[model samples]
Target: MKRLLKQSILVLAMAGMAGCTTLGPDYQPPEVDVPQQWQSSLTEASTVADREWWKLFQDPVLDELIQQALENNRDLRIAAARILEYAARVDIARAGLYPNLGYGADVARTQSSRNTLGAPPDGVGRVGSNYHAALSVGWELDFWGRIQRSTEAARANLLAEEYGRRALVLSLVSSVATAYIELLSLDRQLEIARDTLKRRAENVDLFRVQFEGGVVSELEVAQARAEYETTAILIPAIEQQISITEYNLSLLLGRNPGPVARHASIAQLVLPQVPGDIPSQVLLQRPDILQAEQDLVAANALIGVARAAYFPSISLTGLLGLASAQLSTLLEGASGIWNAGAALAGPIFSGGELDARLRVSEAVQQQLLQKYLVTIQRAFSEVDKALISSQKLREVLAASQRQVKALKDYNKYARERYDEGYVSYIEVLDAERRLFDAELEYTRRQGNSYVALVAIYRAMGGSWVDAAEAVADKVDFPPQDAPESRHWWEYPPATRPAAQNQP
Candidate 1:
């Protein structure tokens, strides 16, 4: 009996100390084509990135509004809450590695009627009172590493959620910047219209005196008044646009429609320089890319968890306590009791349940792999589109500047011709119309140029840093050509939570 007891103890200890082999496929990063660099006509002004893009225009008001939106944006707040929720999930997943110990106590007094078959009877004797106390522990040994894989997957999910929140933050920041630029453009347009209105008013006064002195016709005086009123009409239109844009900006800040304060002009606005970093660097900084990668990681981890299902799950459960029928003997040495159990369970027949789960996990991993590739494609597309947009807007601005200059010259010539009686009022009106349209066009393109710069910054990943070396953190994974079937053990054990990426 002593030899058998020693052998049993040896067997149990060996089972406890033996390393469980994890059965699952390894993860591979999805494949995607990314250009090494952007090709464009615009100069790469990497040094000018030191200042905020808005400050390039020297507009303090525009800067202030963007800051306010960042602080008050409700969408951003909601996204932050979601990140925290995922953080909690990560904590829950990590808890699986520890034993679950619970302390329980019970005191019961019972009385029963006369016996039926072997049942006891209250009439035979007073019902007994029982007291029981126990500390129970149950721990599923991670011999097959199912729980470890699950924990790893959860950690990846937390990271993905974090990056998702950062993506939302980036979007919010861009919206605020875009709206403020538009507001400034509108302000500039209003100023231009009012200035033109004042000049036309002067022209109207001069034309009236000329007509009264018999130097010009009533048609000339009427045309001058029409031009002045036409310019005055644009002021209100521009003002309406300003109101709408301000309200739109207020909404972006998660506020009601109200006035937004800013101090900047299109002329005063500064343009941001294009950074010269290769597009490849953006993959490391962009939040959407990281989020997609983590999603792929979680899908990969689930495969291990599913594959491990094929192996028997080893677990230990035990209870140590004192129980006594008499209240006086409950805590006495004679009432001590202890129990322990170990179980290894594997499915013999589940009608393809395990196979189905394994296949499902693989299929889902493949799906996320495609989505991951798509995200990379999207990131590339955005950068290219922004590059093309900025280049074209810059060209348009240059042309509009020339057009504005030419229109000014034409208007001056028209005024001189009218004063010398060399042209009719219709010619002067045409020149004034051209000049006004040219000025408005030039101002809009200027704002668009600034906006295009914002797009470039976003596409280039906007200065947020991250720490991830490939996907796995536990053990080093061998490099593979593709995302097909790969070896496990490539994932590292240590994980960084997503919240650490926040500013």
Candidate 2:
């Protein structure tokens, strides 16, 4: 019997080794249609997409705010936490590849009535005490690759979570930068409004004086007062917006509503130039796209897992221990007892459950495949839109600057004409009004340009925070033979490098 058991074990081991083939289709990244060049005419230059892109703005306060949001943003923290959760799940799935061992002990007392137990001792009850201790082990051999496929799926999920975290970080950086730029723009507008109000107030006094001297009508004074009040009204509304924006930023920092620190005004901030030649293939490096691909990989692995369920599951269970009525004898050889067994379970009749599950898994894989493709396409669209927006907004900003300049000149000349009685006060008022509106619009255009640039960086999957740099304070020397450093997204197809291999 023992020899037969040994032979059986050897056969099973050989069978397990021979059946190691995985059951599902191996994962291949879906092919995508990549544009040869962007539609915009921006020159292709070394991409600033990966390196602390926000630093291009050259604002220390803005830099600090982005850093703060990265460290403290609630959504980013949640994403980071999810990475830990999926990592733990990976371990759990991997554990299935190995045996599980457990140790157990028991002490118990039992009594049986004489009538029920061999009529013991002339109708007297029988009592017994027992003690037991054992070590148990069980393992499901991956003869059909179920455990292996599950582990593969789990590992892919972990990677997806990690990529999700990266996507969140990218988004957080862009959001903080955009918010900061808007705040500065609003501040500039508020300044413009207040300054315009002061000038309008001076105009009201001038109109009143001219009326008393019979040089102007009371109607002129009334018009001047109305314009001053209009400018004054804008000040409070702008202030309200600033307060709300600050509150929103505070939430991003995981803090209660409060004031955010500011260093540079809108005029002092310069929009970063968009990097010239960007490759469209760089969209693949986007974290969200990578995350979606991982999801597809995981779904693909699940199909294998479901397919494996159609094969026999082989498991071995054994207990090695001693059992005795006396606790002291529990470890003695005379009390030793051992049992071992193997099980083979296969789907003989499951009312089509196994077949349905396989179909479900396949359907899920197909869905994820489509979603992954969509994600890639969307990423490309975003980059294209941002590229065009950046170019067009630059033109808009230039025109706005020229308009502001011309309006300023017009306002000055109109004021001089009014003083010389060469034109009506209404001309001066209209010129000033146009200049004020142009100044506000110009500031807005500047803000929009910065926002569009942020979008481009985000769409390209740029990184401001390096994983290594976060843990260390010092910079490493660059390799002497290394090619000019390029952002991850900037490498052309012939020169594109693969990411580091993961276990």
Clashing pairs in 2: 43-276, 43-277, 44-276, 44-277, 45-276, 45-277
Candidate 2 whole-model C-alpha lDDT, 0 to 1:
0.78
lDDT of each: 0.73, 0.78
List, residue by residue over 1-503, the lDDT tens digit for candidate 1.
33443454455556557787765766665556667776564565573332344456566776666666656667755654565566557668768776687899999998655646656754567577889998777777888889878877887887787677667666766777888888888899888898888889998999889888998889878888988888888888889999999898899877999998877566877776665555465455588888889999999999999988888877777677789989799889788777778888988898999999999999999899888888888887787788889888888999999999988899999989977989887988999999998998899999899889888767766453111111111112222432444212112112333444321
Worst 10 residues of 1 by lDDT: 466-475
Clash count (model 2, backbone only): 6
Provide the RMSD of all predictions against the true structure, rounded to 1 decimal. 8.2, 6.7
* 470: Cα error in model 1, Å: 24
Clashes of each: 11, 6
Off by over 4 Å in 2: 1-18, 43-46, 121-125, 463-501
TM for candidate 1 is 0.83
Off by over 4 Å in 1: 1-17, 47-57, 118-124, 201-233, 277-279, 464-503
> Can you write out model 2's per-residue Cα lDDT over 278-364, one digit (the tens) per residue?
667766877788889999999999999999988998888777677998888877778877777889988889999999999999999
